[model samples]
Target: MARTVRFHEIGGPEVMRLEDLETGEPGPGEVRIRVEAIGVNRAEALFRSGEYIEPVKRLPARLGAEAAGVVEAVGPGVSGFAKGQPVSSVPAFSQNDYGVYAERAIVPAAALLRRPDGVDAVSGAAVWMPYLTAYGALVEVGGMRAGDVVALNAASSGVGLAAIHTANRVGATPIAVTRTRAKRERLLEEGAAEVIVSDEEDVPVRLLALTGGRGAEYAFDAVAGPGVTDLARAVAPGGTLLLYGALSGRPTPYPGFDLGMPALNVRTYTVLETTRDPGRLRRAEAFVVSGLRAGVFRAVVDRLFPLEDVVGAHRHMESGARFGKIVVTVTG
Candidate 1:
């Protein structure tokens, strides 16, 4: 039997229970992996609390989508993978269909990526989701180019830091926005050209002044609420505002009409748009792999928790005090 994390009811981190479960064989197009590390994300917290975009389809549901481990077995019709090979699982599958928070777990083959040499379990587990989301939205879909300026919020989170690196890699400038000064220096050290303290200063005004009144070419917003209106004011003419997350837990309103309807374009995006597509995923993988090999990218982990302390890990993530990814390590 494998120790797996599951929730019987929708609630806080206290509701999650690590119970012994049968480690079953993989079905068709699936692979069973011996998980070594799991990446904790806000999505898991939202899922457990019944506030995610995708609802809990049934009771006693599993709770993770990102992990790094060694392959133990492959189901029928699966190729390009073998037993004992190192691999990392990305957030490419639905949590309702599968989860990786277990000593042994079965995940779809499509979600597996061969972990590169020199990448340990914690680094592998922490890299994919955040990098893919930033690279896919900014580089692949947004067509971000050199000399462009991108304003992104949630600067201390994993994805936010990745966005800073991605922008710098492409010769663009990344302006990071956070709620307080506690994380300003760290954000600057992470390659952000400028850090905007949203609570201390006016975001749109700072963005406008920094861009010499042209505004940023793109505003990548994670917290979507009434703040979209303020961010809209900082978008250059014909620029796009990409809303990729809803961390605000409130309603969001389109700001075009409210701001006199300037020549602005607004759109929503998610990493799934790239991960779910074969062509896009391939391109993104190549780009990120090149960056990693060249030392242009790195995984930033804030804290590590043992498998038995998954509840404490979730509590830390919800505390809003972390600066990077929270990883959970599994042991025999």
Candidate 2:
């Protein structure tokens, strides 16, 4: 029997239950892993609370999409990966189709990535969502280049920090935006070229001044709330504003006044676009691997919880105080 995290109803973290589940052998083109570490993301919290993009269709649904472990079984037609090889899970399918918060789980063969050297199980679990999301949005879609100025708000989360690292690696100037000055020093220490405190300063004004009268070339936002228009306004002409997450639980409103500039592009993005496409997925993997080998790509683990403490883990994530990714260690 395998221990897995499942929720019968969609509501709060307390709805989650760790149960002894019977995990069967892998099917065709599938791989089974003995999970060691699970990445805890806000998306899972949103998923369990019935606030995600899709509704739960079945009861006792599984949770999580990121983890690292050694392969325990490989089904027919699977090549390259052998038994006992170290691997990590990636988001290739919807959470409703598969999840990783378990001592053992089976996933599609294509959704696994080899763990880079020197990266432990916890680090491997933490790297997937943050780096891929930033890479897909900044490098692949936005066409970020050296010396380009990119502004990122909510600059303290894992994705936010990953964006800063991405900009640095590409020789771009990353302007980190925050609601307060609490994480300013840390952001700078982590390679942010400039830091803007949204509460104490005028964002657009400071952005323009920092860019020599021209606004930022691009702005990456995770908080889609009333302040979206302001962020859009801070973009230079022909620039793009990528809204990736709605942390504020409010729709990103496109006010009438800001629509005057036709060159400014406002769009949303997802990592699945790169994860599912073979060529793009390979490129993304290579990029992440190079960064890791060069010490440029890193994961800051905020805390670790035992698999059964998933409810408390979600509660801590809701507190908005963690500075990096949280991992669930499955010692079983």
Candidate 3:
């Protein structure tokens, strides 16, 4: 039997429960992995709370889309991966369809990628969603380029830090924004050219000056609140403001007002848009793997919890007190 985390209701962290289930063989084009590390993402929390893009259609739903472990067996019609292969899920499918927060999981073989050398199960479980989300927003959709300047809001989150690393990879400059000054210095030390304490600094004023009178070409925001007004103002003429999340729990109030002024483009960006496309997915995978092999991309683990501590892990992610990825290690 494999221990799995499943939620029978849509509410707080308490809704989750750990249970044992009989392990099954992989089906055609599928691979069964004995999970070693599970990544804790905000998406799961939102999904459990029934606030995600697609509402939870059923109950007793499993949660998680990223994990790293050894491939115990491969199903027919699958190639390239065999028994004892180290691999990780790429978040290419819905969590409802393929949740990896279990001691073992049956995942589509196409969604698996070999763990890059030097990246252990802990860090391997941490990279997929964060890096891919940043890549989709900055490169695939935003068309970020060399020397381009980007403003990253909620700069202390995993995606925020991944944006910092992605920007560095393409020779772009990143301005990290946090709600307070507590994470400013730490963000700088992690490759941000500049840091903005959103509560203390004028985003537009500082951004314009930092870019030498020209605002950032890309404003990657995870906070979709009233501050978006300033973020819109902080974009260069015809620049793009890509909003990805609404952690503030407040409605965004900017595009309607900033419609005509700077002629900016405000749009919603999601990792799914990129991961679902084959070409873009391949590009993202290659880029991230190359960066990891080159030691340019890094997965910073804030904390690791045993599978039994799933509730506390979810609580920590919701508390906004973490600086990097939270991982849950599984033992069977």
Candidate 4:
């Protein structure tokens, strides 16, 4: 029996329970793994709180989308993976279909990526989601290029720090925005060209001045709400504003109409757009692997929790006190 995490009802971190269940054999197109580490993300917290974009479809629902493990079994028609091979699961499948928050879990074969040599379980669990989100949104979708200026908010989170690294890798100048000043130096150390403390400075004005009044070529926002209007105002003419999250938990408005319909392109992106597409997934994996090999990409884990402490992990994530990825390690 595997100790898996599930919730009978939707609510907060305390709602989750680690219970033993029969981990059955993998069916067709499925792969069963002995999970070594699990990546905790804001999306999982939002899902547990019943505020996610996708609603819970049934009771006693499972939780988790990203994890690292060693394959123990592969069902019929699975050709590439073999037993004992190390792999990492990405957020390519729905949480309702498969979850990795367990000692042993069955996930879709398509979501599995071979853990690169020298990548530890903790790094494997933490790397894929954040780097994929940053690369997919900025490089593949945003078409970010050398000499471009990209401003990103939530600068200390895993994805936010990954954006800073990605921007530097592509020769783009990254400006990080945070709600407080405590993380400014850390963000600069992570390759952000500038750090804007939103509470202390005029973000739009500072962004404009930083870019010589032309504004940033791209603004990648994780917090989407009324404040997007101010962010939109800081995007250069003909530039794009990419919204990937709703951390603000408020309604987001399209600022084009409010800003006199300037030549700003406002768009929304999700890592699923890349991870769910075979072609995009292949390209993204290659890009991330190259960056990793070059030492340009690194997983920053802020804390570690045992599988039994999953509730505490979720609480920490929800508290907004973590600066990087939070990983839960499974031990026998």
Question: Best to worst by TM-score, what's the order?
Answer: 4, 1, 2, 3
Q: Write the per-residue lDDT of candidate 4 for residues 1-332, one digit (tens) a residue.
A: 99999999999999999999999999999999999999998888988889988998997999998999999999999989999999999999888888899999999999999999999999999999999999999999999999999999988999999999999999999999999988889999999999999999999999999999999999999999999999999999999999999999999998999999999999999989999999999999999999999999999999999999899999888888888999999987
Window of ten residues with lowest summed lDDT in model 2: 254-263
Regions more than 4 Å wrong, model 3: 254-256
lDDT tens readout by residue for model 1, 1-332:
99999999999999999999998999999999999999999889999999998999999999999999999999999999999999999888888999999999999999899999888999999998899999999999899999999999998999999999999999999999999999999999999999999999999999999999999999999999999999999999999899989989789999999999899999898878988898998898888888899998988999999999999999999898999899999998
What TM-score, computed on C-alpha atoms, does each candidate reach?
0.99, 0.98, 0.96, 0.99
Error of 2 at 181 (Å): 1.5
Each model's C-alpha lDDT?
Answer: 0.94, 0.90, 0.89, 0.95
- lDDT agreement of model 4 with the native: 0.95
Error of 1 at 42 (Å): 1.0
Candidate 2 residue 216 Cα shift, in angstroms, is: 0.9
Regions of model 2 farther than 4 Å from truth: 255-259
TM-score of 2: 0.98
User: Candidate 3: deviation at residue 270, Å?
Assistant: 1.4
Clash count per candidate: 0, 0, 0, 0
- Per-residue lDDT value at 23 in model 3: 68
